[model samples]
Target: MNAIQIKNVTKRYKNVAALHDVSFSFESGKIYGFLGRNGAGKSTLINIIANRIFADSGEILIDDLPAKENIKVHEKIFCMSEADLYDAGLKVKDLFKWINRFYDSFDLDKAFEIAGKFNLDTNKKFKALSKGYQSIFKLTVALSLMVPYVIFDEPVLGLDANHRELFYDLLLKDFQHNERTIIIATHLIEEVANIIEEVVLIDQGKVLLQDHVSTLMEMGYSIYGPAKEVDAYCADKNIIGYDELGNLKIAYVLGEKTPLPKNSNLSASAMNLQKLFVKLTEKGGI
Candidate 1:
């Protein structure tokens, strides 16, 4: 069953249109990469899905029921964003206890385990932790909430490399054991590329593309050789973007299956999510 469905959703702020007729459905037990450039409405869509904000027009359904302020739907979904949601004066331990009491599916033991892994000090006040630790605290809560759907908006924002890898590993382990739907909206596409099964690319508050990663990669190719040779070979194709350095020219092209000429280095290349996002949203058309 679809976990969440958004139909013709639109949001406006004064003279600006934040979202324009956005529609999409999210399935259960899959990791989705919600990608877009800055000001592309990733956070806006996520907030609507979390029911934290109301759309100006259209509707949102969670499990076939209207999701607005529904306690059942709220219990099944958890959203963690960059905005601080905890009480600044509360100690870490107090925050944990409060969350445990509030969330029906909260796992205190798992929360403690995650806190230990991150070396978080429960005695410290919420405002006392470093920026990275603050993010770590929020991540631990999201993981231990054990909700059916977890939406993370740049969860690893202030984390270092080691902690970031650890977060991914822990997230993967939890997914394997709990089988929940995870939606990650972030600019760090390449970091989570391997873990994300499907991708939803948005631009100007509208979805540009949504498909399985493997299928999307099959529609694009990268070729590299002498500048003149590579240019000649890609002459008839839609060259999305390219780069040239000295005698070498690497070009990104989207087309059907075709044979490469001899004397040119040619191979089917995997599409980088970051590059694909830039190419699709750069000119305001996908």
Candidate 2:
């Protein structure tokens, strides 16, 4: 297969399982949102794929080739990790030159162009750049790489509003141009909700769900009305949970079959991506 297949991969740290028999695939030419809460195995999974860390069991394959310790497979995947991999003293321009040499397909001119757009001073050393500018520089490098698969771990970290907007705009433009597999591991679900075609949700070292965002949204909804009316409406439905305020209530129901509430005053609306995520991953009973 051409997809990045992660087959029953597992990783653990002491007694804590970072990834528990997790299996998922990133198909070619699609944007995916890799979502999870803190310590939910997002970084662990990224590290295993990037060969920065090894899985205790199972394997990861790219186009049928094993990924662990395989240089050829790593060539096809580029992960801009959250950790700083660059030397702080290296000048931005020199770092670009080094990257061009390492990755033959890297577009130096394009990287420079993006740097200019972000007002990133290429002459300055990496340590001299602001936090936001550091992210911008890394994003510029990732965007310039002409690779088959690109995994961005917190790509928008430390970026301001304007820069974040520009980053997403450029990311879409780049994806449209190349149509490669782009996986964004981020906490800002609402920001990337519309951009991502698919969602892979992980919680406590396990995949809770993986599906099309639109389909997932369609599978769940919110019903609002009086407490008694809401309870009656959700009685037969699959209620994930609900909120109560005075005499009013809002119940979150899952599944496609939604009949009209018996009471006319009751109202219902489709669940958005953020709401669905929270409902699924909340620690306490929801």
All candidates: CA RMSD (Å): 2.6, 3.6
In candidate 2, what are the lDDT values of residues 1-286, reduced to their tens digit? Answer: 6889998999999999999999989999899999999899999999999999999999999989999999989889899887889888999999999999999879999999999989999999999988888888888999999999999999999999899999999999998889999999998898998899999999999898899988887878888888988888788888887788999988888887567745367888866577678877987624
**Candidate 1 clash pair list:** none
In terms of lDDT, the best-performing candidate is: 2
State the C-alpha lDDT per candidate.
Answer: 0.87, 0.89
Q: Candidate 2: which stretches are off by over 4 Å?
A: 221-270, 284-286
User: Candidate 1 overall Cα lDDT vs. reference?
Assistant: 0.87
Model 1 misplacement above 4 A = 223-238, 242-251, 256-268, 284-286
Q: In angstroms, give how far residue 284 of model 2 lies from its true place.
A: 4.7
Candidate 1 lDDT for residue 144: 93
- Writing each residue's lDDT as its tens digit, candidate 1 over 86-170 gives 7989999899999999988999988989999999998999899999999999999999997898998999988999999999999
TM-score for model 1? 0.88
